[model samples]
Target: MRHSLPGGTLVLHPDELHDGEAGTEAGFRYRMIYVEPVVIQQILGGKPLPFIPTGLSTDPRLGLVLETFMQSIDAPLERLEEEDALFDLAQALDAVGNKRRGRRAYDYQAAERARDYIHASNGASITLDELEYVSGRDRWSLSRDFRALYGTSPYRYITLRRLDLARKMLLGGFNLVDAAMAAGFFDQSHMNRHFMRCYGLSPARWLSMLGRQTCTIVQE
Candidate 1:
């Protein structure tokens, strides 16, 4: 978001789809953080977050904090260290308080409810209107609030959730086909397309490497 987002916000997996813009400005200044959901789960040691903190803004101070935490994630991190990253995040959120002004309470609540529903039905093909109905929100208001609260739209969230599940299945010794099914992808091809963009490798190759790692650990 354009307004200074309060710190301590945790954007969920990349598959989750988030956007950034300057608040209340013409021509919207834009920025985005691109990282894989697998990276986030890796950071969290392969655990799924039913919910992760997020929807922060880009302030100068937040910029520094974000850059530093990002630097530490040279590789997908383990779950234990996620707390370490969160420690730094807590400091940032304390700096930015809740309650974004010029935004209505109903609007904010509707967006949050919609996102929460998406999180609940991750990987399912839920329509935008469905999301709004469950959230007691209209499409236009939900769209804007969804962006502000979760940094992504209903459609994007479903896709990312699918991809995130796929990554987890891969790490769990599921083959490419299984991973795709598990993640709610239509097929290996579908999983492959998203995987290539997010992880820079084919699902088969990723599964192979993961398998080898598991084997090595078992041997040890």
Candidate 2:
């Protein structure tokens, strides 16, 4: 289908059947961000997914949301900035949509306990069953709640926490292998895969950027 996506227009829930093509001979340039539904779920706090009746919206609030999130091609998002943006975007989305009720209530307390457990075990291998025990919820329910509240699966949450620790170690001049091991990854290669997926950069490249960022801070 031929359609125009102006600045600030969003196309959410694009399934496998959807594809895009340029309408003009000059072609189009755009950036696509792939967000896991769990991320939105966390921010929306179990509210049904917001339905934007038409795929296109010129709502200024959503425009601000998109602007806050989309970054330069090679830039890394600071943790706080990303979280704040998601919160605002979620609020805006929730306010615009009609309410729908879920069969089961969202369990914020259990999910929070699981999150705290993950934080405490950042450098250890944790299983779903283990989280189930700690959070006092069944394995399946805990898993679902965790993602609904935290924007990631329990396994992925652990990996991200490890990567955060590894980034700190690397910034402190530790070798990649040591950092990876200390952060609880099985090996450097294992860390490398997850790091790239999370940061859109290899460890070496991220380190290089970190160095430049540090230098800029020192100069300032």
Winning model by TM-score: 2
lDDT of 1 by residue, 113-136 (tens): 777787787676676557668989
TM-score of 1: 0.45
Candidate 1: stretches off by over 4 Å = 1-106, 208-220
* Residue pairs in clash, model 2: none
Which candidate wins on lDDT?
2
Give the Cα-based TM-score of candidate 2 against the true structure.
0.50
> Please, what's the RMSD in Å of model 2?
9.5
Clash tally for model 1: 12
* Model 2, C-alpha of 20: deviation from truth (Å): 33
Residue 109 error, candidate 1, Å: 1.6
